[model samples]
Target: MKTEKGFSIADLKMNNRLVLAPMAAISDLPFRLLCRKQGASLCYTEMINAEAVARNNKSAFRLAESHPDDQPLGLQLFGARVESMEAAAKKLAGTEKFDFFDLNMGCPDGRVLRQGAGAALLRRETRACELVKAIKEAGKPVTVKVRLNPNVLNSIRVCKALEKAGVDCITVHGRTVKQKYSGPVDFVSIKRITKAVSIPVIANGNIRSRKDVKITLEKTGAAAVMIGRGAIGNPGIFADLQGHLAIKPINAMFNYLKLFEEFGMDKFGRKKTQVIRFLTKVKKQQVIELVQKAGTEEELEQALAELK
Candidate 1:
């Protein structure tokens, strides 16, 4: 299904090249719906711990919750154990909700690294491949997201191995583990990977606007672009990138609040954090302070209305 507007990975098809990265404590069901409502073609759940999911952790399962409208969703899994990864994939697949599984081989979080997962897996390509193979046994299209290797361009070999191991797609973040989220993205390395791989290569890192997406796609020749921190405050970035009208962050936040209630998500902590992200761009510091101190959603909503 290669076309001007869409592409296919195995049986899953995406109508556009915009995807929301699986962010910790961020990419929830409501967040996915808002992004998709605007224009994101594919969305992933917040990174779920494979070991936690395998152990049937209620909190981990809650993070993977989705609605019928949240179509073409990918449940992101991160951990080092092949047995745990397999069990987690099987457990989620039995629910018949997720469209695919995204293996998190790119996370630079020290906590994950300490557990022998994330970018650390890049150092263990054999184990990463083994984890992918075990996840594949659960019978779903699997994708791996990774950073540029410690040696940079060496990431090509990692993607190549994952591809040979039957991964449906690979996403290259274009930054080494050492750089984390601070340095410039290596588009040259991403471009080289696109040239080296036969499957779709998604270019990620520092893409925040439509212009940024265009430049990344042109420079890397990637099939799509994944937005990470950029989409946190503005889910409308997807619509803007897709040639639609630019959506105001405040407006999108209101929509998020609506969805928040519609979906019955009661976690005030998650709600407050999302509100703060959506309004972080607002120049009024007092408003953010008020938002932070607001004891209830109503108080927060009233405070946000002041921005309008």
Candidate 2:
């Protein structure tokens, strides 16, 4: 599956076809890098607030960080206002060297609904179409990330507009906004969208195992499958997709703890011993008891010292 032309997002040839879904608060630099090492063809930053980008927020800017190894990364942005989104895309295009700009149209958070972003954009076809057009104008590949809206009878209409508007690829989550993360994912909708669009369609939802990935791709006839929540405490799924082998969840936890620590968890004014104590999930009551007996940070250090 390797391409000599290097990796890309749209017309772009990636090292592999597997991609990590842009999850909020989960797909940070360390997590994406870990997945990449595990054989993820490509990975994206967490879905960032488009309005934050337009306003030049430092936290949002930090989300865009990538290393040399994190090639062909997708930068996902979200917002309701087309103008703001366009400006943010243009700004990102000018500075950040991303393989593609992904529009977030699938988030179901209440705050996102309040701002008319995420799944809310799905209902406003005219506006969503315009945003896609603007992203296309940015000279890079335009990808839209969406979920199946429960009330959307015109799903085909929306897909057609996205295609006609020049979106290079579309990633469809199987669940609707109303359904949130509940129930089974509607793979049928994904199949319908796949048949309707000419470009690559990615199927995402409840993909926890290699078996699920295999079945999903076959059932939906999608070009790729995007893994999200399933990869949080488990990254071996990437390795499994590569046909290597599946490791135990304990092994995954060992790796995640190292990753979390190296990525600055220990820098919270605590020594290594104190940090590892919290990381250990022996029992909630035991942790509370340890914290309760400590009169100060020094006492906490002594208590942890005795345990070790």
Candidate 3:
């Protein structure tokens, strides 16, 4: 078997190129660190609202927290306005230690889109170009995550604009706002975008297993792959993609559970059960089903009882 090498967002060679996508509510410090430990070449902070960061919101502070160990971490922010987005980028560049900054143009949530943030910016190509230019001015390797265009012509146009704006790379989530997360990712469209741009393109959307990683790389010709929902609770996928299976699924489960109990509960001030439920939502059933089956509801209750 051939081994796959990794690269940081700076193009620094790494152990693997698998990136953990920034997921809202799930990609906390603990989760991202776990993925790093499990061999992810890169990881990102959860998508933060740029408005919140620009306003100096304390909640935004939590979004950028990281341990010394979590190096090569990317901080992703979402917004539309040039000044607010630029201010947020400046804030991150000022004090927050991060490997890079990512603009979230791919988020399709109605709330975000309606506000002219996230995927809404993709529709406004001129503004998206300017936003990328602002981040580039911040002296960081700027990456942009964009949704696939409802019209392919727009996809190519956005790619051209981002490249011209000097983004280091563009992560194309191969689904449009209208498509949501419905069908299979449109790798063909991603390929077209990749071909249209000079900068690196990281293909994201529905990348689940090791095989899928290789196929996505081949099909889309992206410089790398970013795993999102598929990576939740399955940190070992990072190692698995690299031809190293030193970490087991059970170990990953326990590690994720402990992390959830620690940072998750403390940060949210929620009961352990509530935290456990939220973590489980991102976790696959196969990993948690065994634990759930071994313990009765009461026994499971006892497991989390120690948490609070």
Candidate 4:
């Protein structure tokens, strides 16, 4: 199928304009692969802590891991210090298969904010621009994810600064750091950023359906839409965005479980719990209970088969 106009960052070209947001814990390899299969043009690894990567932390490195099938993936790094961010990016550039790197200035979690790493950068414009410059110097196609600042005008300032720092693209989540995930998304702010920046701008927030995707792209004139919570248990939303029917939850869950095992994720129990919760939103509670009770993957598969 033909895709939206080509989205390129330097020499890298994506198959489509739809991108999967770099969600913490939720955007793991299994979930990314599933989104890719369902039509996500590009996927991002969960936010990686640069300090942990600089320290050679195994867990942090694992978060950035990808397989051959997960091509065109972006590794998002979060850190307040330029040296650590540069060190981590340079090291991963040599060893990782991601096509690009994204600087995380949009995350609003209290932990990230406390470290002055994520949305806190909104207030420290100089430091944020410096970090973008350092990462760009690390020799990779780079992007910055940012949020609308309280002043709104400040968001445009940051986008321009990032572009001047030579970032290839920018993602603008339509809410401020204080709003976090609640309240209405400021699409007008997103539109303003897209108008002010020369590079591609990806619009994120409250994008739950195909109609929402269409409205966002049309209204904001963004290059693409980034799906977060909306894609959790329903990767089929990507297919639906392309005009196909949604994939059955049961079948999608089966595929996710298969990929989960294939990837050999260590936290199967935790992931399984998450899967059950997402499924419960769409599937019967009794069916979810049965799946949860099934201890082994084999048992889980059988239970899913029964649902079919």
Candidate 5:
């Protein structure tokens, strides 16, 4: 199960060290499959609200849905309460749907923090440990994602606690919750945490290119690198890392659209918007304007064909 650039963690075997980070609304079924096809070692579903899943919310269930092709997938759950977290884990375990699970402790959104979830757990170490331990009890391999605490050094302490709670891996986003996504990434603190834990450490944040991936692993000694915004419009970034031909935006867009329709997600306007956002990243201004003006699939396809 081990390759030069890949490793196995519990039951999940990754093909490489590059992972597609869990992104809300952006890491949907079509996008995940696209990234996986492009060589991302693993991909996670957007963070699901534990409370909602515990209540059997249909929308939350849909978010966690996976196909056989989405192997080595991980489901991420977010909640402040041990009861809800445990309940959600149990619910997902019963489905036997995912290769593993991740607990979200790194989200910095105001809405998540206000609910005492996400990055708020960084301040409540005891609660965070309890939540992770509760999920582990579901008998699934679990990982935890976290950001540097107010005191950056505290990341090592938190990571050690998670390891003790039996987390299979740890992904550290190198910015404190307060810093959100701006400013510099704290590679120093990430390296400290990697050294502090026996489990694999996955470094996230500011990873844009293959060189960035190499630099992160070299500097932090992390077992892997997780890319988020960098892969927004460019799943080919993974192919680039694997020394494959860089995929053109038009071709990538065609494949993505085909998969999007195959997944029966065409009714969602937000999904089209997601594709448009990716197009904006790689398309010329005029093409972007045409896509922006597109009101239907035909119009969008016409706009995309111009690039071909």
Candidate 6:
């Protein structure tokens, strides 16, 4: 599990342990392709709304789109209602786009919390387990992503219930809802979940570099590490974790632009917004302004070239 060799959970296998966490509005087709090319073993779609999918919403299915090369992907779903979650999974059961379905119980967004989903499920462990069981009825492999409980180390208890509910795997994002994404990942809590559950426990939160991957794997004893914010614009971070040469941010952005355009997803400033996520090193106001005002791939390239 520590090595980058093939890891399997309930018959789902990937060549490596590096996985791209589902980021809303960020893990689209083009972006997932970039990550897959950079060696992410599995790239999950952004959390698809179960309510929307169950309601036959085209936008939800569009968000779950994938390319031919983005194989072995996971379709992540988020919803508080078990009936909607079950219906959504049944609807997507025949799709070849995803290899498995992941339930999102760790998103701390205010809107999601208000709906009694995401990390709100972290506080409602019983309902969370029921959601897992509901999706498993669709006959595809299911996993759950969760966060630690505030003021106590109860993730192990929650994960145990999920394991009993027949979850294929579990991803533990080491921060509670209250902590959100700010504090250090609680490696101790993640380690506990890994030990408590028979299923694979993925360690997430604050994994940005090879060093972070090394330490997290060692301390948490997790089967794999999931990267979210760290991989926003730089997909090569996956390759970097394997001790290979990393693609420069500027270079990655150009490649991203090509993927962006080739996929015909260039409307409504989506391309421009993604281009900005790759500017991890650009600190100048004028260069930032140039990127902000740019309208086309060529202009974005020019703006990035300024940093060189």
Which numbered prediction scores highest in lDDT against the true structure? 1
Of the two candidates 2 and 3, the one with more favorable TM-score, higher being better, is 3
Which residue pairs come into collision in candidate 5?
A: none
CA lDDT of each candidate?
Answer: 0.87, 0.74, 0.76, 0.85, 0.84, 0.84
After superposing candidate 4 on the true structure, give the runs of residues whose Cα lies further than 4 Å from its correct spot. 1-3, 287-308
**RMSD in angstroms between candidate 5 and the native structure over all alpha carbons:** 2.3
Winner by TM-score between candidate 5 and candidate 4: 5
lDDT of 4 by residue, 1-308 (tens): 23466587668888787899998878889888888888899999989999999999998998999999998888999999999988898889888888889999998888989999999998888898888877877688899899999887888988898899888899989988788898998888899999998999988999887778878888888888899988887888788878866676667877777787787777757666757856775857876877789887777666667566
What is the C-alpha lDDT profile of model 6 across 1-308, one tens digit per residue?
Answer: 24467578788788988999999878888888888888899889989999999999988877877777888888899999999999999988865367888999999889999999998898888898889999999898899899888644577778888889889999999988888889888898888889888889889999887788889999999888899988887888888888778787778877877777787664547666776777744444576678899877678778878555
Candidate 4 whole-model C-alpha lDDT, 0 to 1: 0.85
TM-score of each: 0.94, 0.81, 0.85, 0.92, 0.93, 0.92
lDDT of 3 by residue, 1-308 (tens): 12255444556454566788988876877777778887777788989888898999988977887778887888998888899888888987898888788899988888998989898888898998898888777788888898888788889998898888878788899998888887889999999998998877889888777788878988998878889877765676777767676465446545665765666435432223333544474554443444354334455545544334
Best by TM-score: 1
Off by over 4 Å in 6: 151-153, 282-285, 294-308
Output the lDDT of residue 96, model 4: 83
Model 5, position 289, has a per-residue lDDT of 76
Question: Candidate 5 — what's its lDDT?
Answer: 0.84
lDDT of 5 by residue, 138-160 (tens): 88899989999867667777788
As for TM-score, the candidate ahead, 2 or 5, is: 5
- Model 4 — TM-score against the truth? 0.92
